[model samples]
Target: MTAPRQRTLFGLLPWPERQAVAEALRTETIGGIVLVGAAAVALIWSNTPWSEAYEQIRDFHFGIPALGLDLSVGHWTADGLLAVFFLVAGIELKRELVVGELRTPATAALPVIAAFCGMAVPAALYAVTAAAGGGSLDGWAVPMATDIAFALAVLAVISTHLPAALRAFLLTLAVVDDLGAILIIAVFFTSDLNLWALGGAFAGLVVFYGLQRFRVRGWWWYVPLGITIWALMYNSGIHATVAGVAMGLILRTTPDKGEGVSPGGRVSHLVHPFSAGVAVPLFALFAAGVSISGPALAEVFTSPEPLGVVIGLVAGKILGIFLGTYLAARFTKAELNPDLAWADVLGLSVLAGIGFTVALLIGELAFPGTEAGEHVKAAVLIASLTAAVLAAVLLRRRNTIYRRLYEEETLDADADGIPDIYQRTLAVGANN
Candidate 1:
């Protein structure tokens, strides 16, 4: 028997208006571009002569003297505000699991396997590098991330040279890669915690979900409580970012047109903008500001943490994703998307290696100490830049070559109404 939907989007406005607004919200693609730009700026800052001021600027304080939060520059911005990034991530994840590509195991299998390999092999490669070279293997997990913004940005530039099958594989591969990265962070990267605060955070989550049950449409009611939940979780053993994800999930629902707007669309409308625009760009400005003071370019390679991360992201990611997907597709007997060739897969695999946001994120958490974090930043830049270049070359084939490369097929739009522009772009004026 179906349990009745506990609530709907009924509010001061008509339900249709609310849903229409939500659909409009879902369609905005500007956030993705902003995020890509942010990652690029951060990498550029870390690698440039301005690294000293960039890193030091974050140490400055904000707020009134009496109770000002003195989170270091990056922590204040990346850790604190980036929690909102996690919140949006949580919403996307919930939606995907409920009604998107992840809704089917058969469809999900190749990407899922590819994601697993992409994450696993990089860590293993880093571990080998770390242990053999007198590095800290505890930092092994740092290189397993694939930054979607950077990856997408690269895809944006090179989409015209690849086939549709290749583009689809890359998107699915990246999505699953992100899922794996989130799991590693939640499970592997946290520090010690306090139970009382944890309990409070749990209570806040319950309250948030309870609002969903009651069909609460007022976003204000949920936002403050979400912040409170973050504070409690921060004070508790759980990472503060986890709190964002928790709160975001509570308020999100799936859309089904009914007597009024769908409950799910209301939350999607409200959250996607904040997450994509404000949260991600701000995160870029903050996280990317590492100054180039302490170490020279040559020094980065000598540092174990950064070197490991660079190797992992560049060499390990490309090798692992290509080999893993190839093996899994062979073994699982999963049907390959017919439009792509093996060469196209290889080219797109290079794009998969552009692990900017998440790699640096892991780098920060893994090497919390000052100089160590710098090494992580340096290595990430090296690897990301290398991967970005290689992807471009691999994808930079002639249109005529790819035209001869594959045939036609249709693709679906993301929940956000943007069809896979990457796939569409790949066809590049060919007959659809």
Candidate 2:
């Protein structure tokens, strides 16, 4: 007899699809581990007796002074190096829009809605708390971000048996969250507009677009152009990282004739390693090195800013995402993927509260060089750690259930070409 066809659910994707997600997960997991290690080292070093040395290294400046480039090591890591991470983000965003799950409205609705809720609810919570306590409202956006590397790393460790669709959902939600953070930085956190420099940045972006249209093929040719665009954007009032995203979006997403890879894919492939392994870790190192002495810890507890941030990240993220997902499904008649459960979504949503990277950036922008800023940084670190611990505890239980399901989906018996579970499923469906 011909073997019965298997039902594909979010729990068990097709092999090729699973392979793609697995590879992406592997990359993010490694990067996440490195990023976390760097942050931990920074925290330890900063709080130790050698804290001044860490500050000295971070504050050392050596770039050309004439070109307005005399930035400290910390600034360079934050502004220059982190652009690589944003570039990869932009490329991934484009791919999703053009050909991935986000290509269709139906597929994109849930995560997009959840991402929006995730951002909005956190901002509202922070604002309300900050305002009620007579604290500055500047850092409201700090809690609105989801650190993809940190979250994915946590997932990789605790959710090894989770469905591929869950990974994809988290990835897409985080990407959208990053995009929202970028827009906030550009719009609300900008300095006074510098029109001439802004115009120059746009001109460079146009040229960069033209280069891609002409099928320009080498990293060497694009590097200088990318730098020039970054410089112009830096001089513009907008954050320079937006330039990287613009360039990334400008690159073609699909391969040209006789080409093995698209420009976007090629650039991402070349830059991801550097961005993940070096740039992000270095940025985390500088950004995370906040001294947390007894006094500092006391300040974190007494400060309204940290309290708001903590609540926003830990409580706001989970409630917002779960409610948003439910509302989206309810109003749109979009069913949750068959292989996943509401409980799985709840666990993943809780894990999403681990906001580290962009939260630190916004904290700096919101309260630069102030006591409040330091408190905000301390709060982010603490909140992320809390979220990580909570997620591990919650997801560990769910992991056992998923592991059993995963095995059932993969196991074949009776010399059949199909998994025995699927055969039984098909037989049950036929009887029904």
Candidate 3:
């Protein structure tokens, strides 16, 4: 070998990396719990002797058709419940844009760009491969979502091997992926006009925001209001679930109020756990129930259900997100997140391809990827599973390579009579 590579310095960092690693691992475990629990419940509901009961869910009626309809379930559970998931997602998205990562365009640039790349490439690939068409056009959005729960789980699994910067990059990128999914849903999959219902829903959301300012009490304080918004949106022809997002925004706690001290903080504390623990888990259980007893497996390939979802989520999500982020960064001069290398970015981009929960939701309404669209969902599930396992493996390998490289580089610098950290510091002062 010509000469051994030198350590880049972070490896020799003075502070312990264990704490940060532990935190990342903890976050990952939560993520894994959510995914495994949701996936497990879904399989049970979809495959058992109760399969018929599960499939009939979509057709089950919930609201009074004549007495002014309300949210009901059979099949509505998957779509309606998932709306809660979207609502949380939307709430997170809006919050990020306001005060979080997406707050400043500059700070937001890297992930925004990366998210776009990740989305566009996957969609284009899905369309070409699946020749996904006709009514299928409506479901183009299926693959655009990142399923942060699943993606986060993958992140947790791969955390040990990844650098801190790469972890930051994945989090940011996943949000961007969620943004694409939301926009796609709002724009592409909506129904015919329900102007009256929509108008009322809009007004209710405005009132909810005002209530937040007044420091509303108890989680139930906004419940009636949120329910009304949901009802209005449902009748208004807008997807009723959009109301969940509206509720999140309205109910977001103010930071100024704190420590059982502020009403806002208390409310957030209550809602955060409730939403994460209860609402999200409920949504996952309902949404994951897809029916498998349909035409033979071979017939599924030709069916729109499997083809659309499989291609859209697996092929479309990755390609779109990766390409969008890549292009945005390139032309705009936005930096990749500090710790992430192109290699790291690319691997996580593969994980972005996982769209299990949200993909299932879209399949029900626009495509019906399970009973209605198994061929498509099967494809999506297979692809997503494949991507998750492979990406995890690759990230582990990359981490090993990085550790070995760091040691070699450090040793070489010492042999050359230069202390890596001390010499670099002196050189900077000399240059100054």
Candidate 4:
């Protein structure tokens, strides 16, 4: 008997996982649309007669004096609300690392390599551009992120007939990309070293993990602890979002005996809607209000830092991801899924260039409160929009081709009463 076939990279997901991913994608698609709308409103309002009001609202500060939390509206969204978003991200990442695509070396290699190269190339390109133009290289990491929500939204808009594996690949790539972005923020963006607060935050995380290890259950137990950890983390001089991710990672992803879902999965399900629909969109509403005038638009191209951001997102991401995938398949045991073509990979690479959310966060950190910050934000917006339009054009054509193929496949399956694809899959399983 022939041995069971080894799964190729980006191969089909199992049914249950596939269903979960599909549901998550649908939710994210809606969130992406809402985020885009919020961004548009921010841009229009920022440029209108009430521009000052927009700025005033974003810059206004109020806080809990007891908690040492005095922050502007924009900071609250970025540091506070965005923590909820990161917590959800952390849960997703933990799931992938534990039981999803990243659980094994063979399945994880391609996307992980692609994600690293994707980040490195953009940072390198940004460094080259910024240094050549005598600009600071502080914003080198801004374009390293792929906003999954925006990318998914673009795919939904295009009505792509791309394989499910392709979407799974994007999701895995984005998860790794997020982890990289988080590390960069923690290492590069932090200023004051409040060791006391940091230690306190770490202790809270330990207790959080202990609770998970003991299988201690209850929202009451977690909610207050989560808040205290977040507050301490904020005071610790590291980004508060790091606390959110820490708590998420500490949560158990595998369900206890007789449980329907893992704690991490349950929390992710409950929190994901709020994270995507409210936290993320609200963050975008505050972050994407950069000036887009004739001169400001010109500055995105002329200014060294902002220009680097544009190049990094539009050009660097494409080259990084495509080349990384190709080289891995060429040299390693990893193989691209047979259902996808190089052209499909190219389109997905372009789609990865829609670096909106974390890109804006990095830009804010890199240029904090400077005129350069605004220009860099504008560059991000411009580059992301350009990437989205280009990806739409390419994917739409590919989608048409795939639609035809799918129609033919469906017709053949109807005649045979069983699809050839499924027949082959069953045969392989039977052989095993």
Reference-based TM-score of each model: 0.79, 0.89, 0.77, 0.91
List runs of model 3 lying over 4 Å from the truth.
1-28, 56-60, 63-67, 70-76, 130-135, 214-220, 251-254, 257-268, 276-278, 291-296, 299-305, 368-372, 402-432
Displacement of the residue 281 alpha carbon in candidate 2, Å: 0.6
Tens-place lDDT digits, model 1, residues 216-265: 76769976887778777776655578787676566555644462545555
For candidate 3, give the lDDT of residue 198: 83
lDDT of 4 at 261: 95
Model 2, residue pairs in steric clash: none
Tens-place lDDT per residue, model 2, 1-432, is 999997867577888985665455347777899899999999999989999999999999978654467788988888889888899989988888888878888888899999999989988999988888989889999999999989988898777776677899998899889899999999998999889989988998998888888876777888888888888788887888898888878888888789898989987887787787789999999999997898888777678898899889988899889899999998896666655677778888888899999999889889988889989999999989998898888778777766665566666445664556555434322422
What lDDT does each candidate get? 0.69, 0.85, 0.62, 0.90
By TM-score, the candidates rank as 4, 2, 1, 3
Which candidate gets the maximum TM-score versus the true structure?
Answer: 4
Off by over 4 Å in 4: 1-26, 422-432
Distance from true position, residue 39, model 3, in Å? Answer: 2.5
Model 2's lDDT to the true fold?
A: 0.85
Give the runs in model 1 whose Cα sits over 4 Å from its true position. Answer: 1-56, 63-70, 161-167, 251-253, 259-266, 291-295, 398-400, 403-432
Quick one: ranking by lDDT, best first? 4, 2, 1, 3
